[model samples]
Structures are given as structure tokens and as C-alpha cells.
Target: MPKGQEGRGIIDACLQALGEVGAVGGWDSSSPDGVRLDGARLGVSVTGPVDPATGRLFTPPNTDSNLAGLDLGADLARSTGLDVRVDRDTNVAALGEHAFGAARGVANFVYMTVSTGVGGAVMLDGRLLRGVDGVAGEIGHISVDRVGPSCGCGRRGCLEAIASGPAIARRAGDLAEEGGPLHEILASGRALTGKDVDECAAAGDIAARLVLESAARAVASACVDMANAFNPELIVIGGGVAIAHPQWISRACECVAREALVPANRAGIVVPAQLGDDVSLVGAAFL
Candidate 1:
């Protein structure tokens, strides 16, 4: 959600993309701040693990603590001067898949995003499951290891703690000083990104290879657990990490097929999300 040369937020990007596509008017959505824009017919802002009932992000994880009590949804509706619908990003992405992407004909599926953070949305029997607090499908917080690194959600060994982009990048940067190949890779003095790990692994950097492989295995294990629990027909993967490394889906599929229960194993489908980056926006529109 960083701004561009002209201080463009996701809304600005959406506006430009809409213009290029000759959209008469369109809705904008993201998990960040409100912004100025022109030509948008409606605006949708999906912010936080917030309460839809109160539009408040009370003690939200992975967001500014100051946003804890803000009425993000109502605020956006005011600034945009058009109706603004708010929901969790994961749910929106799941809706996008159901309405316009890979799960077109399917009735049950899980939409997971593996980028800065890991999250998921679940649809069962043709309905999105919004739990009591609209916080269903919070797969990122599912603890995978009891003693692994701590997560932003204040938990240890959560899937996102060990397998997310930042998590992978943080581990790579920490091990960069271990000597040999990684030393040179960290010469830039900043940090190694998840993509950097992939590139270095491709060039035979042992540390990078290990980090990527470990992340892949973590992803596979987590997906296997989900397959067993949800018994969904499909798990559509998206987000920066999945797009950057298409192999994740295949690796996860291999693991799920081998590890999940007989019926669940046969039913699960792991595939890349079809709407790509647009799933969030498309899903918000449905909201």
C-alpha cells in the first residue's frame, strides 16, 4: 500500500487500471488508508480484522495500533462520497474467485494468500463462512509449531510466522551472516527479500535454498492440515509469494495428496487463483 511517484495508493492504481480498461466507473478496494481519486463510481475498502458490526479494528493484528478503535468503513464511505462496503480482504478474495475466477462452477473452496502475511477464506456448501465476529478462515494464525518464531499475532510457530514472505526474508537476512554464499548476497546491507532467496537458490546459494525449501515444506504441511479439516474441493492460492514461485502450489498438492485423510485427500484441489491480483477488488465489489 505504499505510495508511488505521485503519492499513489492502491486506489490510484485501481483508478488508472480502470481508465486503461475503459471502465465507465469502478469500485476501489484495499487494506489500507483512504485516498483521493477521480472517476470511480463506488469505493470499497476492506480494512483490518475489524468488526463489521461496529466498523472498529479493536486490537487488530499486523496493523497500526492506532487503528484499533477507528471506524474505517464508515470513514471511507464519507470520504469517497459513494457507498463503500467493507469486509476482510480474505473474504473478498474468496468472493472474487467464486464470482469471476477459478471456482466458477465449484461450491466449496478455500482462497489463500501467501504474501506479506498468510490468510484464507472458506466457502462451504456454496456459502462463505463468516463466523460470529466475521473472522472465520483466519488460517494465518493457526499455529504450526509450538516452538517456532513468534508471529505478528503474538503466537509462536503460526504458518505466517514461518512461511510468509517477511518471515522467509527475515530468516534469510539473519542467516546471511553465517558465511559463504549468503555473505556476498547480503553485501547490500539492507535485507534479502523472499524473491532474493529464490534467485540465490537458483544460483546455488545453499542458505537460500534451505530457506525456500523449508518454507515450501511448511506451506505443504499447512495445506495438508487444511485439506483434512475443511475437505474443500479446491484451495486457490494467490498473493506475491505464490505468484513469484509457481512451484508452491505443486509442492503443496504433492504433500496434501500424500498426507491428508483418504476422503479429504481425494477431494482437495490446490491450484493458483485465476483472477490474480484482482480477486480482492472483485470480491469487495460483491460485498
Candidate 2:
């Protein structure tokens, strides 16, 4: 989350940006959407599970704000004076990739993000798969360990707990007492981040390598599962952690090739996402 911004505050800032750009003359905040803006509509992709039908948000375990039950679409429409549509960030990113990036022309694929937390969006036969409750692509919550570190979702041993960005930092912190380069960094009172761990691994720090390798394996395990179940033509991996460390994508590709079932292994190819940070932003336009 941005510094000191949440809920309506973030929305207000965005509305302000639109005004500055002359996208909208000005927002009253009282009168809402349903008004057209040169026949344009706004598509917003946000973190966490979204109600597929109603565009309401559920409390995302990773988010500091409890956005549960919030009707973001209605609010944005009301304020922005344009038709508004909302979807989970990963879902839109998958759409973005399919429409313009790595998965272009690919009919079946999964877009996975290994950033703040592991997330996924599935495209089956060229359509987004939204399960009954609109929370189908929650690959991060899948239990890899019956008993392991707790996850933000209040589960034990989720893939997020093992391989997400914060998980990398936490794992490094746990091993910091072993007196290695990681320990020295922690000793300096610098909070460890996934980028820090990746850099350390690049520097040949044993503890950092161990932590990163562990995460890689966990991610690989999930990729194998996705391959077996979805049999996607490609699994597009993105997000800060994977983009910063290509090793994660390589590890997933290697694992899938080795362990996925028969033709499934041959059919699915894991690749890095091409759109970079603008992926979801581009995807939102398609919403």
C-alpha cells in the first residue's frame, strides 16, 4: 500500500490525478458515475478477491485495510462519472497478458504473480474462470505443508507462506541467527525484503540461497499442480519477486518439465510475463 493511503483516500488521489490529466473536468464526489466520459468507461483491477457478479471486494488477508463488502465499482462510478468495472488484479493481468503481452493468442494459460503474495488467474479456452464465489484463482492459499509457517490467510503452510515476497524475507529473518551475511544485515537492524534476499543469493550467501531455493521449490511444486490440473498452454509468471529474480520462473519451468503428468508436462510451458509493472494497469483497460 502507498504511504498513509487507504480506502477513499486512495480513490480521491486517483480522481485527482484524472482531473489533472483532464480525463474528467473535476469530481464532485457527491454525484457519481452513470454519466458518460466521451463514451469511455473505467476499469479498475484491485488486489484480493472480488465478487464476480457485483464487483464487491472481500477482505484481502494481505491488505492492511479491511475492504470486505465494499462496493468499489459503485463508488468509483459515482465519483468518476464513468461506467466502472472491477476485477481482481491478477485476473486483469492475465487478461492483459492474453490481449497484449506474453500470452498473446494463447487460449489456455495461467497468470501467476509471485510478489507480495502468490496469486493466479486462469484463462480456459480464452475465458476467465470465475468459480461460484468468484474466488477461483487463489493458488496462494493452497497448502503445500500440512504443518508449516502460518500464512496471512490464517492457514498453515500455504504456498504464500512458503514462497511469497514477505515469506522470503521472513524465512531469511528466521535463519539470521546463524551468523552469515544475512545475519550481519539483520544485525544492522535493516528489515529484510525479498529483493534483499535475491541480492544476497546473487552474492553467494549460503543462507540467502537456502531461503530463495526453498521458495523456488515451493513455487515449482505449485506450478506442477497447475500444469496437471489446468494443462495450460503456458503459465505466465510475473510480479515483483519473479521479475526481480528470474530464477523463480526458471525453477518453475524446470519442475514442471520434470514432474508434471505425461502430456501435461509437454503441453505446459512456464514463461516470464512480458508486460512488467504496467501489466495489470494495461489489463484494467480491457476490463
Candidate 3:
């Protein structure tokens, strides 16, 4: 396990989970020091300010925040007893794909995930891009609308707040309650999940479709901005919501081509991603 922000709780949970799973010679960095294995000494490295109120290091929960992953990694290495390897989660995803998946031979590409949140990573000449402090490719926090909903990172109108799976479900649930049959169906379920919303949309439920369209539009708008900025040859989009609705991939590409700079629009581009739920796990294992 690699610890960044949310380290303490994640570390505790991972320790319990690992024990339950019979993991041996485990590695974890759920602390500010460095990495820790079972019964090991601590290493020290510089990270960032530990939040006085929370007693936890203040790392960026999303791109909108000023903190960076390098700081987190250094802190973990210093405080724990394991060798810590760190990079943005999205960057790791891109590396995983380029090393073994759809982008194996590609030299320029971007990887994006659109589930509870939206995230992105970039590859150039088959190498992952890690910005200063290893915080490159954080697309979720990109400000799309100046006055849109407030993001988790205390920002307004980020791509994440508008297009992530949870965002879609929230919007859909709100719309469904306005006398739609889909709303009634979702209401009867144990919980209103993003999967349910996508299924309903696929089944021609008006409310569900509306919600999906809203999210898709926001995602498309963000993709357009990214396309213009990076102009990569391919954009691989993964995550639960996107995998459930492949049409969203096409729609996003269309929106980008229609809205991005002329040169970027002219570049041959496509949207796709291979690994699904296992992406994060695989990347974690690599770390």
C-alpha cells in the first residue's frame, strides 16, 4: 500500500484487510514517514504541512488543492520502513496501460477515469508525465464553469463536480423525483447507484437519459479543453460509469473535435480504455 492523503485510515484498513487476506511481507505507507512493512524501522523525508486540526498531512485531495504527491511520498518514506515509490494515481494508470494494455505501442496518449471522480494521466513517447511533485494529469479539478457546483476541493464548477459518476447520480436522482417513473424505480432500490442510472438511461428512461446527457456534456466540455491542451493522439477513458456507457466515449470525442483548437481538432483521435475495476489495484501493486 502507498500512502498519500487519507493515509492513516487507509493504512489501518489496509492492515486489517491484508491480514484477513493472508498477505505476507506486506508494504504500506499510510503514515507521513515513508513505507512500512511488518515490524520495520522508519525512514524520514520532507512532505508538507500536517493539518493542525486533523493531525494529518495536508495533501491535495484533488488537483484543485495546492499540495503535491512528491511531498506525500517523501513524508511516507521518512516515517515508515518501506521503500516508497510515488506518482499520481492517474499517471500510474497511464504507465500500466502503456506497459501492458491498449497503449502498449502508442507513444502519445492520455488515460482518464470517470467514476466517483474524474482523473487523467498523460504519456509522451511512451513515458508517463510526472509534473513537479508528481502531480501531473489531474484533470478532475479543471475549472469548466466559473459558477458551477462547488467541488470537494473547495472549488466551484470543476469537471469532477459536473461529470463524475456520483455527480451524475446526484443530478439524476434530483431530476427523477420530479414525477418520473425512473425516479420511482430508483427510489425503491436499496440505494441509488450510478450503475442503476446508466441502466435506466440505456432502457430509455427519460429522467435517466437527461441525467446522463448532463454528465456527458460536462465531460465532453472538459475533454475538449484537454484535447486542445495536450493534443495527444489517443485518449483512453476508463472507470465504472464510462465502461457502462461506451457511447459516452464517442460523444466525448465528438464534443472535443467540435470545440477544441483547430490543430487539435484535425489530429486523429479516439477514446478508449481497457482495464476496468482492476486498474487502481494493478497500479497499486506496481507501486
Candidate 4:
């Protein structure tokens, strides 16, 4: 899978999988339209927002323009000759959780992922909230600090800029420069990760604790806001950073309880995702 050929790569993989399953016949790889996977449906979970009406992706923050305005569902449908459905990765993940994970049987809930980047999906009254443009639930861009660091979305102090995995590493790196346990790890010439920060904090490293605490506060603030806005029954936290650190989830739950509106706090409870990495995979099937 080479750069600039991701679309082709996905189609090839789909075709190969269909062929292996006896759902498609022999086809020329070069001619994607040579054959069809009749009656088969494909679901694509993408990294950015997608217009449900047109099935085209919006210009994602800090991403290649090629993805912007691209009708991925149409392209994949044409290439693989299968019914293709597409939506933001987080949105599908919410569906997955609602159908089989922590949010199961919950009618109103929020799903947030704190992995490579922070993202969220809102399910209200048992339905996904696709805004007028079909790109709602972009809580990552919510500004926690108006004067804080710049985000890839060209905003100042976005939650993603402060609490994403990369953000956690960046925060740790800043402390590392001042000579701390994080610095000792950096001295080993190994790049830092969110997991590293979690481990360091678990070991009682002051710098790591400070960094993680700051990130947790930011996340909690966002959760409080979401609780007030949606009054969800649960706020399901997922992704690498959250799963790696149960303390982070606990901290957010505490914050939400302490800071959110009385009714919202009483109604909303933050919890961990149960499906692990298979959340999106299972969700896509539901789509």
C-alpha cells in the first residue's frame, strides 16, 4: 500500500476478499470495472467527516486535499461493484459500541476516542446525530483554552491539541526539556508515546503526573460540556490513551461529577469502551 494509492489499495483488498469468499469472479486488477461483486455491500469508516447525503468527504483538518470532496462511497462502489456505505470512523465506532459495546441498550450516549487524535460521536434518542451537513459531533475541535497551542484544524487550544496521544507526548516532551523522568526516557533516544507517559505517571514521576493530570482535566472539561449539551446516559471513552490509563477515565468521571450541571452530572456517567479495537470493525458491519 503505497502513498497516493490508498483508494486503489482499498479497492484491491475488497476485491481480493470478495474473490476469496467466492463472491466475485476473476478480474483484471488494472481494470477495476471488469467484474462485479453482485449483491455485496461494503461499509467504509473514514478518518474525517462525510456528507451523508452525497457520501463525499469534507476537507479534513491538516489532511490531503485529495480526500476533500471525494465521493469515496461512489468510488468504492464503482471500483468494487458493491453497495458502499461510508461515514466518519468515530461515528461508525459509536454505532459499534451502541450495538455491542459499553453503550449497548443505552438510548442516549456519547462515544469519544483519544487515540492519534481526539474525536467524538453523539447518539441521541437511539440515533446518530448527523448534522445538517452530516458532520456533527466534532468535539475534538472544541477549544478548552483560547490562548493555548494551535491545532491541526487551525484553531487555538482545541481539546485534540491538548489531550490526543500526540498531544500527551508533546506535553511530556515539553517537560522532558526541563530535565525530569521523562527527560531520562528521552535521553535513551526513544520517542515518547502516550503509553510512556501513563507508565511514568504510574511510577510516580512528577512530570508525567503533571502532564497526564493536565490532559485529564482538559478531557473532563470536554465531557462536562458534552453532558450539559446532550445529557447522555453514558459517555463511553475509548482509544489508545484512555484504554492504557484507567486513571484517566476515572479522573474524567470525577470531573464530570464535580463540574457538570447538577442534573446532567446526575444523569451522565463516564465509562470505558468494552469492545477494544474491534469496535469499529463490528460497527462497520452494522452500517
**What residue runs in model 1 are displaced by over 4 Å at the alpha carbon?**
1-47, 79-81, 262-268
lDDT string for model 4 (22-101, tens) is 53345333444544665677777888778866568788785565667776778777766677888888999999999999
Sort by lDDT, best first: what order? 2, 4, 1, 3
* Candidate closer to the true structure by lDDT (higher is better), 2 or 3: 2
- Model 1 residue 95 distance off true place after TM-score fit, in angstroms: 0.4
lDDT of 3: 0.64
Sort order, TM-score high to low = 2, 4, 1, 3
Residue-level lDDT of model 3, residues 1-287, one tens digit each, is 33343445444444455444434444554544333464432222112223211223345554323442234444443444445555455666676677667677789888888876788888887676766545567788898878977887788888888788777777677777555656776657755778778787787778788777777777778777777778777788887777777777888887777777854445446567776655555555554
For candidate 4, give the lDDT.
0.81
Higher-TM-score candidate of 1 and 2: 2
Residue 12, model 2: lDDT of 71
Cα-based lDDT for every prediction: 0.72, 0.82, 0.64, 0.81
**lDDT by residue for model 1 (1-287), tens:** 22222212344554444344443434343324333343344424353475655455566576555555555545544454445556678888888899999888789888888888898889999898888987888888888788878888888988888788889988877766455566676775757778777777788877788778877878888888888888889888888887788888888888888888853436337888889877877877777
Off by over 4 Å in 2: 1-4, 23-39, 264-268
Q: Give the per-residue lDDT digits (tens) of candidate 2, residues 1-287.
A: 13246677656766665665554565342434323344468878888888856778888887755567777777766666677888998999999999899999999998899888889999999999999998899989988777878998999989999888899899888876556778778889899988788787787788788888888888888898998889888999998888877877877888888888854437339999999989978998888
In model 4, which regions exceed 4 Å deviation? Answer: 1-7, 17-35, 62-65, 262-268
Best by TM-score: 2
Among all candidates shown, the one with the greatest lDDT: 2
